[model samples]
Target: MPKIDVLAPRSAYDIECETLIIGAGACGMVAALSAHQQGEQVLVVEADAVPSGSTALSAGLIPAAGTSIQRAAGINDSAELFARDIQAKAQGENDQALVDQIATDAAEVIDWLAQAHGLPFSVVSNFDYPGHSRRRMHGLPTRSGAELIDALRARCEALEIDIICERRAFALFHEAGEVTGVAVSTPDNTQETIKCARLILACNGFGGNRELVGQHMPEIKYGLWFGHDGNKGEAILWADKIGAQVTHLGAYQGHGNVAHPHGILITWAVITEGGFQVNKDGRRFWNEAQGYSEAARAVLSQPDGEAFAIFDERIAGIARQFEDFKKAEAVGAIKSSNTLEDLAEQLGLPAQALRETHADLPLGETDGFGRTFGDVPLSAPYVGVRVTGALFHTQGGLKTDTSGRVLKTSGQAFRTLFAGGGAACGVSGSNDSGYLSGNGLLSAMVLGRNAGKA
Candidate 1:
């Protein structure tokens, strides 16, 4: 018989632990750390490298509702109030209970990010991203995910948590009705079974998963929503196989942006911060600060979720006109145009109309005509990026309670399965980016920690 015969009598590489976490992104990493601290032996098995996935792509701001920070800041928030706010604001879309729990712990999670990782941040009370309440956003200086990952990675390593990367989990292990472990496809194409009394499905969403997207957000059937190619709804698929209940199937966040040559749209975390948008004809769109989410809706409602990121050498010249477009330029903010002809041509707009359109307009800034990066709009180097909207992250996912407990389809508890972060159902889908701060990371940290602790 061949060494790898038909059934090979259950592999010898099986392993066991107290908790087995899938995906090592922010959510999974935080969950592992939390579970480990609770005296549970934890293991994290990821399909990619550690600290990768959407967490790597995220801005990494952890925002919660009622915490010492929010209280001290005089933000008057509570779990009940938070839940009500999320539910009410979401228009009965996202899961009320989960949103409530996240709001409950919003600030403490950010505090943990600062205290645990030395990630510096300061509150911008009355601050607004685009959608949420005024100035409640607490911002990190860097506004990047690397800072948060550094903290999470170190903690997991110190706790001696086993992090197995490139291991593709194929099936959940179960006996009777409880999920006991998972069967994963190893890098060598071999199989291994890992065991645990508890499992955390922090593998993220189906936004990148075409099948999932098509089935749920059918409006996006032909729509483009920039998402990781690797996110194929494996978590949702796995959840389904285990008979786990899933809801909020139609909900998804819109991220409209300029499409790059890479098939990925170059939208922004906050266009209201940099500048405003203009159609291909050099016509200004909506109010810059008024409902920045209008961009998301506006972009999607168009022929394509396409728009030209209109900026001028003049606004580019204004250093403080915006944040720091120069640094952003170095980081590849968007494309530019000097003469409207070239910009229109590059972005597929009518050149004569664009020029004629601007010829009669006031040359100086008038309340908000074009991009105001800073200074006097430099000179020529005007730019624009052809962009579109993408699914970003799917809002609907596994249902959880106020404590991040995985709720069964039957409205009962699903033993050993807990979900949070993007993998969990319920998000404030008022559909505005740059509206609030730290929602993704904060939700993960707060719920992940609580679930582990519970």
Candidate 2:
């Protein structure tokens, strides 16, 4: 329930700006910076007391190809290869034009952040994400989303950009098909209307809205919601009122291995680095190599809708690079033992079944689930963490052109409206299975930059 206030000609406003952006996450922040770089006075309004959104909850990793970092690391990748990876993972269900646009613009965005904003970004060359054919994942030194947001916020501060926090935008005012201003309310119910020549919506999607999630993504409706609470689909609602085109409302990014009860994310690196998941009965159910988004459904279908991620010390060392994994270890969510039997006893799983499952791991050959294990088997000192599925964020919303202009139902662009991040339809196709790692931030930063530059 968001409403659009139709305005007459020559309406006055208490405040004004050349470019106004809603939501202070990666998308909005980047848009603000890009607009400012273009000599446009910009203002950003955030719903929460701070700028933390779904971006802060993530690993802060962005996948980009053909960057200077990639070249320095001697890795060969191109925008075309990245687009093919996205298409192959989504099974060709996504818009090829949109995919190509993001893929092509991603490297430039990454380079811009580093060169202009002084963000210390480097490519992650250790291991490859599920769908990526190259090691193009990039992150800061800490590999933390909070760090990324902090860096962007610092840059905004240095540039003297104005970001107003604790202002929740409730209504959009427009004349005909062109947006004129937005109405925001404070926590104390004080309301103000700010006029702008152009408006960008980066408030993210509806994963946090229970009603909308149940309506569109009922399959993961009952699962855990791990996204920002302020993501209530207000952007999508406003788009609907304005007749802006929306598509793939059911598409979302989900995770199969969130530490249960601890509410901490166990990095998917453990799984990709030779770890396996088992139900309470200690049995492998599906092909875990199919990507973490699809694993949400596979894990939810298990007994009690819960499972345990089993890995060895070597894998744990690799996962230590992630801040979430360290937090998970701090809270005792991760359990380690010198033997599988001891680890099974600690996790309350059947010892015999756990041993048999471990013994059955194929070496140099694909298993029944089509995952091939390496020649090196998991040695002693086993580690495990109790996990459950979670819906991270919705991938579908208002459809926009490559320049990030919101499009009408008749395929015409709105005069002064643009959208990015979760507010716009992503390249994940129509389901969770199509979500490649880092696709969320990929869309957020790329589209946000494009929208501002346009």
Candidate 3:
């Protein structure tokens, strides 16, 4: 067993440790494990109970680009190739050296997740969401995010790391340009201050915090469906108090599928069949027959980045051919109507345009006798689910070098502030998310492990 010393502050106890990590998300958890394994005294303080935040809500996909595991599985991919596809998506905005380093180290990250956290992941082919030429993603079991988090939690518990839950980090302590500790408030209006030598801010996004979202990603400011209930942007506020810089505040990730009011989430396959995507006026915007990824891009590019996936009963059933889409509807995204007029009235789209465009699509494909709508086959009973822009998952945060050390604007190192996962800027330069299984998770794990070592 690794010698673990969980330096916890009980009832406002002053604490000291070699490494102190905030948030218990996948990145924080991985960083804790790596640091502890390296003989560093580690303490982790979480704002919520088990599995709270984006790591709990992730698809559990980790794209370790190239590694021994991938080699053992005979998936012949290279670090250079992975970097190329990511650069293409970014249109050359990302740092070339950083991108290459992450690509080369991706596979090792996957192996660590499995070997260290006991994540039972498998290689997924059809991993191409919108980009990437190779099958370079890893995913958990059907339960997805839960499985990965469970493994991480189990490891944390075994290590005896202090995982203080139900405590909110109200402020960070700093001294002379260095982060020192955090001030936390419990449910009962009691304040607790914990101190440490090295502090890591892994606290997640401000998506659930409406004010922060409004200030940062103003376009679809209110349309985020953070699967985790407590995605308050404490990290941004904390970083600000400590003189940390937050970059890419304007860019927020949006998904093509999510439910309404309750804001349940869904997958993009809903529009793959003959369902026509309609803009505000209910006119056809993009070919619904295209792959789910292309559809996401097309929808986001629409007027104000809004559209509804119009499909009938037939299209819904066809989309259900894939089990994930069906399960996604359980979380929201699937809408229905007994007749076309009801759907049109509900979504406030032009009824005639919808009728004219989808009138030719049959509910079932007998022998694939269609033009393959957008180069991908079409199927359906016309269905149109209204989808608005969503902060799908953050693609960037604090700027960091490939090693996960927070970097200065001058391409130098920022003192002690290391970030990984969506909390850190993605190695990918552009706004588009690659068809990556584990890109975000991999970034967090590999870089976080590196941060732990540092």
Candidate 4:
């Protein structure tokens, strides 16, 4: 039911701009900034009063190779290795050319944000994500998506770029296969049409649309939708009406560790730092190191659709860098105990099964799931959080060329149409398991930069 209305072009408009961007999230903001840098009159519109989308709900880290932040942190990484990591994780299911382009352009995008926009970015060298070979994640001081969005919004403000919030674009107007303008409505149901030479769709994916999720990704249809509510498949709907080529409709990003009832995101650092997850029965289910995106189905399949993330104080210390983790702690979502037995009792898990599960952690060899435990094991005092699986956002949308130009089914580019972020087919291939850490922002910012440059 939430679809973009396609209409014919009108002679006049309420506003005009050289380039118009839909959605004020990371992708849209980046595109607006990039276009502004090229002396293009850019205007950004958002459905909400402020720019808070899926990016704000994330950890706000973007993976980039060969960045100054990485060099300053003494990390040796390159675009080729990053591309290989993506391809390996996706099992070569994604487009190699697009992967390479995104990988190569990533560092430039990071550097540009810091030097040009004055966004303080630093490489997250504390630990490596699942598929990445090196530590290349870059984030702001808070290491939160909200901080990233605020910084981008501030940069837009400093540049005098107009960002009109609370204006939802509901209709797209085109003439002779070229996008001409869009129809937007305000909170009071007042309508306005804006004409633009070029249009970029950065409105994100359809994870919030229950019907679209049931149609494309029924696997997580019943799971919690943890993304922005405005992501209702408008970009995909517009693309469909315009006959744009779409691919990887089933690709999405899922998480297995949203704090139950509190609804806060628990960073994967707990698991990566030697913590483990157990079902309500206090039995370890699968290899958590396989990556968080695939863990959604694993966690959801358990009894009662819930699990407990078990970790120690040292791991919790590392996780404290995330604002979400701190919020979860403040809200009492995290429970701490001095011993495994006490922790099991607090979580209502079977003490004996939890002890056996903890004892099975291999120190030398790989476990059944091929995850190797380090010499340092979880010790007292122990910490645990009740968590459930959630659908973060969809990873697939309109198929585009390397430059972020939306293409028709016949492989021809639309003269004035572009897409980025969740509106574009991502590099995650065709499934949740293919998602690497920071892949969502990678597509969002890089493709957004491309669209703006175009």
Q: What is the C-alpha lDDT profile of model 4 across 239-348, one tens digit per residue?
A: 77878889999999999999997899999989988999999989899999999999898899999889999999999999999999999999999999998999899888
Misplaced by over 4 Å in model 3 are 1-13, 67-74, 227-229, 238-245, 269-276, 279-282, 287-306, 310-324, 328-376, 380-386, 408-415, 428-439
User: What lDDT tens digits, residue by residue, belong to model 3 across residues 1-20?
Assistant: 11111222344445566788
Arranged by TM-score with the best first, the candidates are: 4, 2, 3, 1
Pairs clashing within candidate 4: none
Kindly state the number of residue pairs that clash in model 1: 47
Better candidate number, 1 or 2, judged by TM-score: 2
- RMSD vs true structure, all candidates: 5.8, 1.3, 6.5, 1.1
TM-score of 4: 0.98
TM-score of each predicted structure versus truth: 0.78, 0.98, 0.78, 0.98
Candidate 1 wrongly placed segments (more than 4 Å) = 1-13, 65-85, 124-127, 138-140, 262-270, 284-297, 300-305, 311-328, 331-384, 429-438
| Displacement of the residue 16 alpha carbon in candidate 4, Å | 1.4
Which scores greater on lDDT, model 2 or model 3? 2
Best by lDDT: 4
Q: How many Å off is the CA of 413 in candidate 2?
A: 0.5
As for lDDT, the candidate ahead, 1 or 3, is 3
